[model samples]
Target: MALFLLAFFRRYLLLVLSFLCQVYVLLIRGTPIVVQVMFIYFALPLLANIRIDGLTAAIFTLMINSGAYISEIVRGALQSVPKGLKEAGEAMGLPFYKILRHIIGPVAFRRMIPAMGNQCIISLKDSSLFIVIGVAELTRQGQEIIANNFRSVEIWGAVAVIYLILTGLIALTLKLIEHRMRIV
Candidate 1:
């Protein structure tokens, strides 16, 4: 939704909104996601005096962090849509939102598939990072088992394999969807 608004009104709202959007993207992409998570989970409560649980913090952190990058991908895709299509839509007396919903969105989303797939893979793997904040994710669970059983190599190996399987499944699923959605 943020990306949609930004891309749709970017020209009309270019001056203030564009700068704000750029700033948001810069801040999100500049810092490591781990740091972002840490800040939200720890520093936010300290500064705001509002207590949020680790899970909530982690979800918010990941959502905002991923949202920034995804917005950029979507923004680029929206821009890459051909001007002729927009012109044609206008010629047919279609409204802007109709053109966007029926034409630009579908085409640009198709273009965004590969990049979106990668981001999904990254997010899945990154969930492990929440272990640092004691969020009890897959990596954290693996670590606990290793600590109890003293099977570091086996546990870590299994964890790695699980992650690999997850990413593979994500890639496979995306490929299937891409094939189905392909223009050919």
Candidate 2:
């Protein structure tokens, strides 16, 4: 599965990209998400000859955005894995990769859950910014409906409620994952 490879690749990528992650977070966190969205949607097309649809552009932008934050969460989790555990695993003659796979990763991942959950919620909300690029996500779809009907108050209110429900569902799903992982 793609997810399996993604997880494996992400684990090693976090180690390799730790410093880059720090820079990305520092640079982007100083700027507004709107600015980032605008640059991706507007500036890139001007500089390059390529043209992408709004939805594709949105996905690309959000992946870059989320990756920076997620990498830091991963790096911190990797660092938080006790040095003693690695040493003990070494003492048991486990290979470095085996130690990482069998010992350090599982514990670090459990501790990383809450931070990753927060990142997931952020990514979900950040998807809303795609509307500025004319991506017909929930917000953009709602905006089109409101624009046609001229029911600003009710339509936008419903949009906000829908966002709230979507966020709540994300939180609940993360909680369930945390619970199940904890039980194991």
Candidate 3:
């Protein structure tokens, strides 16, 4: 949704809408994800009069938080595509969608892979923050097991390994994709 909004903003930027997007990005990026989770889990129910479970709140907060950063990544990637290529497409009488699909999209997607991968890893780590709102995330589950068994070193060490494995897999996958998609 944020990507779609960014595409629209890029193509036909309206002043008011542009300002709103900037404000949205600024607000989300300015605050901590934990605070966002707490707001969604605790305050939203009172303010909006809607019941929300911890998992639901966590998911919503992460989506909102990550969307803001991802949109910026996309915006930068799209802008980084050479203007000359776009102009060349225009000279060939390609429509905007055609130019975007056939020319700009591929280049921008290739350039954005590393940044997007980084964002994914960050978002994965950020999920631990949801534990603060009583969501039974990996960290929370680890904490529970430690509380019962009092094996802090072993349990915490296992949790660290799990996180490292997950993040490593994400990086490896992105690197493979980026290598395969490299311009030849």
Candidate 4:
């Protein structure tokens, strides 16, 4: 959702909105995810005078962080759609929206698949950073078990295997989608 909104803003919205989107992308991409998680989990409540739980803060932080990167993925994918396609659509008397819907969108969507897959995996791993704010995610759970049982090697190995399996599944799913959507 954020990716679509930011891409739309950058592509078709007012100049100010486009500029703001760029600034947002720059800020988010430049900062560390850990700091973003900490700031959202700790500093935001103080600044906004609203209370939020660690889980809520963690979700919001990951959303904002991943949205910034995914917006860039979206932008790049859209731009990668060949200029000839748009020109051909115009040559056929198609409107901008129809051109995008029928020609550009599908091609760009296919291009986006791999990068989106990578971003999904990165976001999954990054969620472990929420441990700083006491979100009891998989990594945090593993750490807790290790602390209790003194089985660091086994616990951490299991956590690593779980993450690997999850990421592998994501990659396989995306690859299948990309194969089906191939432009052949």
Q: Name the candidate that leads on lDDT.
A: 4
Top TM-score model = 4
Considering summed lDDT, which 10 consecutive residues are worst modelled in model 3? Answer: 3-12
Q: What is the lDDT of residue 116 in candidate 2?
A: 88
Steric collisions counted per model: 0, 0, 0, 0
Ranking by TM-score: 4, 3, 1, 2
lDDT by residue for model 2 (1-184), tens: 3322333455556665545545666776667777887887888888896787777788887876776677667767877887999999999999989998899888878888889889888898888878787888888888789889999899889988988998898889888888887944
Local distance difference test values of all predictions, in order: 0.87, 0.78, 0.90, 0.93
lDDT of 3 by residue, 91-163 (tens): 9999988998899989989998999999999999999988888899899999999999999999999999999
Candidate 3: RMSD to truth: 1.3
The TM-scores of all predictions, comma-separated, are 0.93, 0.83, 0.96, 0.97
Across residues 97-158, which tens digit of lDDT does each residue of candidate 1 receive? 89988988899989999989998998888888998789989999998999899999999999
Candidate 2 residue runs with Cα over 4 Å from true position? 1-21
Ranking by lDDT: 4, 3, 1, 2
Candidate 2 lDDT for residue 96: 85
